[model samples]
Target: MAAAASPDRAHRLLVVAMDFDFYRQAHSDLTYADIDPAGHYGAAGWREGRDPAPWFSTDAYLEQNPDVAQAGVNPFVHYLRSGYREGRAISRSQFADAYYAALANGDVPITAAERSAAAEHFDARFYQTMNPDLAKVGIDPLDHFLRHGWREGRDPSFEFSVADYLELNPDVSASGVHPFVHYVMTGRHERRPLKLDLTFRQAALGRLQSFEGRLADARRWARPIELTQLGVLAEALANAPARGLHLTFSHDDYSRSVGGSQLCVQREAAEFARLGVNHLHVFPANGWPTVRSGATRTPMGVLLNGETVGSFVPHDITRALKSYHAEGPRSFAIHQMLGHSSRDVVDIVRAAGMNAGYFWLHDMGSLCAGVHLMRNDVESCGAPPPQSAACGVCIYGAARSGQLREHELLFSRLDLTVIAPSQVALDTWREGSDFGAREALVLPHATLVPSDEPPPMRDGPLRIAFPGTPSIHKGWPVFNHLANRFAADPRYEFFHLASKPATGTTARHHHVAVTVDQPLAMRQAMIDLSIDVALVWSLWLETFCFVAYEAAAAGAAVVTSPESGNVAAFAADSGHGLVLRDEQALEALFESGEILQLSRSVRRPGLFDLKFSRLAAELAPA
Candidate 1:
């Protein structure tokens, strides 16, 4: 009698495969009863030729596995107990039925009507081909899929890409719904896109279209985006005595913002003040400067000696300066021009008749709009040649090409002296741009001084940290990767030291707010925490990294990648840390327990304030 199936075994299999709701609804008589569905199915439901679930048919299972019928036993109980492991195939109504049954079980979370709809889109043969292991086992492909295939990134048919769909719709993945079923039953109706992989040309065109759209949106702003006016700007310049004023151009206000570039500008302004030269700062009032759409007016803010002079359109500012031919002597310093029109800058330079202009490489915005040479805001591209395939794929590629052309014209028109914070930054910029500047030189933002005392040894897992905001260009991804890799390992603990905490990373956060007033906050925190290693794995070639210095000051040995620009250079020159070739090597160092050795070599850092010597020399005596 087919070895009379064990009651315990039969009950367990039936409980897992049988959809109680489907069974209760399919058999109306039991819909109002309180009896267990499995008990009722085992007692008399199968005897009356009833199905166990929406997808499993008694007649179909018996027809495929005739031995169960021959034994005069329940087909689903037999199939789940042995037929599944035996690789039996249910070729007829089984595929669609299994697809529906899988959803009816509550794991897929689709409505009965949607489950019915999802089954119609299932291509059995296509699924079999997509999942050869299930097909090779001669098992019901749809059944295996509903139970586990979707979790393994296996697609059900040609209509959907499981991995791409899950990646595109994280909410669906998080909700634990089968991607194909979701796409077929809901995603299509919701107008969700399919086939996310676009060709090179299509991707590039899409990026360009997006960029143009932002530019168009930026142009649509009202005439006066800010509260200030052109009259105030004109009045400020009119009151000027015109005694060789030093005009500085940046993307934003330097006084309020906190950044290496802003600090440099402030320091340079201080030096200019010391030399008795008037320092006038001009920047795009709307953040990033763009070409005005025909008659669309964009405001530019002006600051003189740390106070707001006024805001005016670039055209009016240039005109006002031109009208006053009270030019005594003028030297221009372009701290940054991220949001300012190169043409506007040229107009201002020409109007003021700037005898010499110094363009600081605060970032690679001069080379590409994707400043820091970070491609698509993910990883560094090493300032590849314009129009190269690398640039073509980047959203900022087209804009970079145009910016480079404008820079070339600007360089040709004015005698610009290029100043980079590091030799590597200068070399990278020179390799990517042919601006033909009158001079190019390096003026480091800060110098490192070694302290007499060595770091104290602490008995615990190495405390590795990533300082500053968790930004992609700052190597947050790499740091996060390391944190995830060694999270469970007892030898290491990861930390994020910044003003704010980050999400989706495996690092313990310690809020270290560093501002102009509290510049040593991060260093003090690192010292208090006894941070062993600082991961300064910046993706871009940093002009200068304040974090590396901060780590050194805290007596922490820095672990950095070779492409970290100034961080890597500082580590090698200062002997404050080690520079790794790649992520693999970094992982290996952690794996080998050699990171503990690095902590032993940590030397205290002292500020060697060179104090902008070359910059002071450049701002000729008034």
Candidate 2:
């Protein structure tokens, strides 16, 4: 055999071939070679093939070729014979030659004969080695073998037959049959086990634990192993070990428990310390906490021009600060900060012993809170307030005032980096603020990444989706008016979350009435309904509306008010849809049939895929 150089890099290469040593022997200048064949060929096949082999006659090929050794018996040939007994005579030589070529060219080929042979060998091996009990169930060794390879072992296609296999293995129980049968038949694992350490505190446990039960339920319906815990529950998730350790703690989910006066057990923190696990997620709730050392004040009034304006801090501020101190995580996330709070919190958290800083832009303060600025009932900034009282009309008035200044100061003070949910938010923040502009990263919002086999798109009466808790601030009145206008169109249908049909009349707008209490089910229903477009008509400032993300993930266009801040950014970049400035824009869209055009274009990848990877990249140990 010969040693051959890699085509691209001249790096040494290793080649392994069964029964066809002559082909490789001819190319002995190759890096390395391992040739052998088992089954019927035996020693006779090797002896006969090498007797007058090409390389045996060519000293040049042999001299240049690296040392060659025959490895294990060829299982592939044995596999072909198994199928041959059933009248399936596939050409072993043709298959072997093709495979040899592919492997030489740095490609791996799974031919029908090889797949059959490997599958059968797997069945016999599973029964002979791993689980002999499987053989007792009249399971056809071949079918069982195929299922084992398809499920636990990867092959391809999800289409398989449990019943056909069961006919062969009669003793296999139906109960055991489900998981393994699912593996073979659907080419999917029965369940994805998520590992969780039991020693975690109740608060931390509660957040991570909730995912465990849901993941369990998800596995029951789908052929995927969903969630698994790490450390303590490692054995439970042994079947699905690819998902590594590291528990997640969103700031919003655990803030109340950690920051409140109760001081619940910090089980997660203790577990990390005990296990020596450095990976910790400090996702905050609402907004990141901003601290002012040496001074403590409650609800201090904010002033722009020496005038007693609105208050700068809310009650949630105190709660957020408390949680930061209690958790003492290795990594901290400034949930809703633009850049100002990132610096402020980094300084405070570092002083408190936390070292790494990571920020997720849940809203506009990090960018331009003035995104909520409006004039003459339209979105406008620096156009002068309609009135002194109207100045307070901006939902994020105090936060937007000195955003650039705050961000500039924050960027320099921080050691790590910051992320925004949308490219718009990142661009806006970078352009408007000087702080860490170069360092700012764009991590979009998390949404359900649509599967390759998406649910069928539904068609019927126009199914308009409006998701949000009913409040005057969310423009429920505007939605109501639009619903009423199209109610008689017969083709129009309406779905609303946290809202109801107007009292006493069978109005055209059908209120679906979803609530936050059942967030999971509500979200699922939204996806199932396949709503054409989600109308986010918020009149107030929204950091980043998760509803629009969810809707877009379900392949629905989003029609939101431009004043909705970051939501408009989603509409612009993803080609999912647009932010309607007023009723006129809505009317024009409806009349010109552009709404349908946008609806058809709503295949934007979910924000979750974009943002999660970006956040992971930024926060990942670097």
Candidate 3:
């Protein structure tokens, strides 16, 4: 009889257990069920079923036994008994909470099922406290159950039982433990209880509620696989067998320390060494450049031909003080701020199997399909996901090229094989990339255009010509400076051949003659513009600087930047004309005898042949 009731029920259960007739003897005028009308002793209050609490307090029992209370053992479990009374219906879901809560609170010796459940539920300290019966038999509770198997309902093998094992290793055993109590706990003769543990669905539904579905910000839980909250992770980790998930802080969005947890550093690397996490890759978004309107630096000291010219802090935006940074044609932030999703772009190489070339990547960044721009669904390419095709050079393709640049260049995936037109372009790509460690190649889009048609002879001192749009990149400011300086000199004559007509100050400028020679044919343009020295001055990498080649082929002594890629390199190789360091050097040349000599000697060494084989080779395998 278990101590499962108040004074009245406890006494009644005791009498029934000792002598079923005893309860009837005391109440001979009544039957057993009537004596205890609640049926606590029959089927209501019992270990196999529901049970009632003691009708009275266990204070008197505690008073009689101080040791039981001092030991922190439940007096009801020790003094009275279970299986003596009945109460309301009990459920596993209801009991699981109570069971864990009770285990958390203290130890108890209630029943075999309760003890076994506790053995599987609580930690080592709690188990050692509750299972003294197993310990006295000198059997490890954990090893015994795992090896010999728990009482999950089969024949109980006495040979493998902890008591038998101790008997074999007698030096380890002194058995005074109650055999009948052990048999009840372990189950009838080895037939273990198979259904004590709940089913997966049962356990899942009967689970302790987790911290999921507690919505947070977009940045808080962007990862689809791993959890973000630390406390939840720690809780999950503590009960490793119950749940399959572990915690992680492996997002690229954080490079510096988030809280005290160091990200993208060795501190976290060493910590994750022992953790269950496998991936912690870095994203370009984490270390995105701090793009600003102004330059990162101002001119510390202006110089010409390596000589110190001047230095000053800028008080305002003026011609004398210039921004050291390059300004983009337009802002791309409008899309993000306005929440306009970028369009999609198809990969030209992957689609057509073409070897990427100059502006190939730039073109792929766009959705240009023949004439109309295409749209990116952003579903085809796998991640790190491809950005919208709408991000590109606005001067050329707007979002088509710009978004593609961000997706393919800035934060591009590793799979893309980027190609270049020349060494100059490759150099530029390398300088501007955190990529190139993977797929990068040097292949030029060039052709040999033989110089055959010679230009008609022109009458002038040294007819120097510079042709291009009035752009900062075209060295327009330097050209204008030269025009002003040589305006009064009759010995020097210059032509500013523009891609289009200049309307403002150029028409009336006193020095160089300005004209819009938009000719339908290159040969005709060369013949009409009987220019001598061709100024192919530009500030950009200029891919191949075909302008320099065209001018050179048109029989003009070309003066160009020494660092302007293939054009400068070719000039050096062919001994074409002058490859200078600065604009100041150009001034000296225009005022020198070499200018006249080079002018007369410049010839149209035509070199133009379509080089499509480079593309073919690029598309081929290693």
Candidate 4:
């Protein structure tokens, strides 16, 4: 049992250890309420998990030494009595050593020098805005920074962030000095960097933000594969077909997301079923390759007639391939191979004895691992030579050379035909490399039916919007930047049309969910909002963008960057919108009032049905 001090001695020890300012700041009600902190600690503060000082956490000490808590003794008293002598480990205090050192000796008032330095660097409003709790208190914000704000990792101003400073300079962090004080005193003189370059972080954040919609779909609709039904699925596909089996491979489950490629796959599968062909859509499980523990096997999901039938984790891949092989004539389509093995795909075709294979040019996944050809998840690299310096600097650069080789091997091993959704897409892919495709052709997803509505007449500033999810590759950042620049201007009103609103953006969010069942939702929303322009500033060479079509369908003039592959082509060919060269050109149009004039001359976008089965018979082997 630990040594225990008498009640009188314990009270004396408690008073000695308690930090008045820290206690008052921690419990705002105690400060300025004329209540003695020591008196409160004796009454209820200790029981309420309040720390006695900056150096000592009451709850932490109790948790670390449960015996002290079990005895119902004051933790501060126990610590002062013997716990300190026993060298018991306590929670590492968030405050620096300077705070503990001052608290240990006696009440140390904020030094004049420290206060002046903090005041020079601090923005009281910024600090209070960042920390709303501190704003509610009547305490001087500058005093708070000198005393506790730095300890709490709060930024002193927009220019100076405490966490950023500490992360960049370990010396300051180790010295236990206030970050803003150190920066204003010496960090600036030492030529130390201030704010972190958030370019890469923004790129990563944009990728994650764009993926949110897909994640929601997966959670709501995607189901785990039925592991036990693998054999049954194979047998059913083999026997159910009156003609032959049609196998399609892609990156993820079509049932889990609304994308152009996913919709095409769904349409193709439905058409195959109507033609008396058993269709099996196979993709990597959970949208990525999963390697089992203590084994080299990866799991794959198999969907038949749009329903996931089974999960196959092959311990012996060759043996598993034989189970899926049907004796009848078989044809295959490789829509994407993002999360699957190229060798495995080739093996599957060889094992199933497929006579012909069709490869879809869906965002250049075959050219590079970064499917959108985005270098570092930022700007488009335009499918540059894999050995070029541009590729060397790209995050996907190292994998591009190897991926292209694998894709070539897959194409060489099969009687392959390359199908691009647009002529521009096909030409771009052809320019990138020679894939030894047996045949290459353009097949548009839908044919447009031009609308006959008269040009829209409006009085207020032209309402502009970015259709679909906010993504880096999709040019959400570009749109966001433009919105911020013109936020106060009455020339434009920005809007984001998607299922969810983007964070830290100035655009007014309008919820528009476009699914297989509600394909016209986006178009309808644009019509309702009286949106004059749809900004499709895609950062990559998009294969075929549905947003451009949807915008045109709503009689909104499509404004896009030249990098947007099919969108640019559609705009130029259809005469439904304008294709600006760059951000500067776009800004120039807005400045010159050319955008408003273009809107008045905007041609209506046509509606077209997507029918992959139109070329199905030709794609199949004789």
Highest TM-score: give the candidate number.
4
lDDT of 4 by residue, 157-212 (tens): 66776787888998987877667777787889998877676653374755543333
Candidate 4 structure lDDT: 0.72
Instruction: State the lDDT of candidate 1 residue by residue for 1-622, as single tens digits.
Output: 2365777777777888888877854554454466888887887888777787766778777777667788888777877767778887653333345446545555655567765676777666666643444534335565556645675566665546678787888898798767777787789899776557653234434444455666667668634555466567667766764355778888888887767777777777776776666678887776653322222245787887778877877788777677655545567888876676667788887777664678888888888877778776656789888869998887787787677776777787788899888888898888988888999988876655555545555667778999988876787877876775566678888899987888645588899876555656887788778888999988788888888888887778888888888889989997888999987798888888877776543433332212224363354545
Question: Per-residue CA lDDT of candidate 2, range 277-342, in tens?
Answer: 333333222233222222222222211111122322323232333333222224444543321243
lDDT measured at residue 569 in model 4 versus the true structure, 0 to 100:
89
**Best first by TM-score, ranked:** 4, 1, 2, 3
Off by over 4 Å in 1: 1-210, 213-227, 237-244, 274-276, 289-297, 320-330, 452-457, 601-619
Give the TM-score comparing model 3 with the true structure, all chains together: 0.34
Best-to-worst order by lDDT is 1, 4, 2, 3
Candidate 2 global CA lDDT score:
0.42
**Clashes per prediction?**
3, 52, 46, 2
TM-score, model 1 to reference: 0.63
List residue ranges in candidate 2 displaced over 4 A: 1-294, 297-329, 337-347, 354-356, 366-412, 436-438, 447-454, 457-459, 471-475, 498-523, 538-544, 561-575, 578-581, 588-618
Per-model RMSD to reference: 17.6, 24.5, 36.1, 8.8
After best superposition, candidate 4 residue 92: deviation in angstroms?
15
Question: Which is better, 3 or 4, measured by lDDT?
Answer: 4
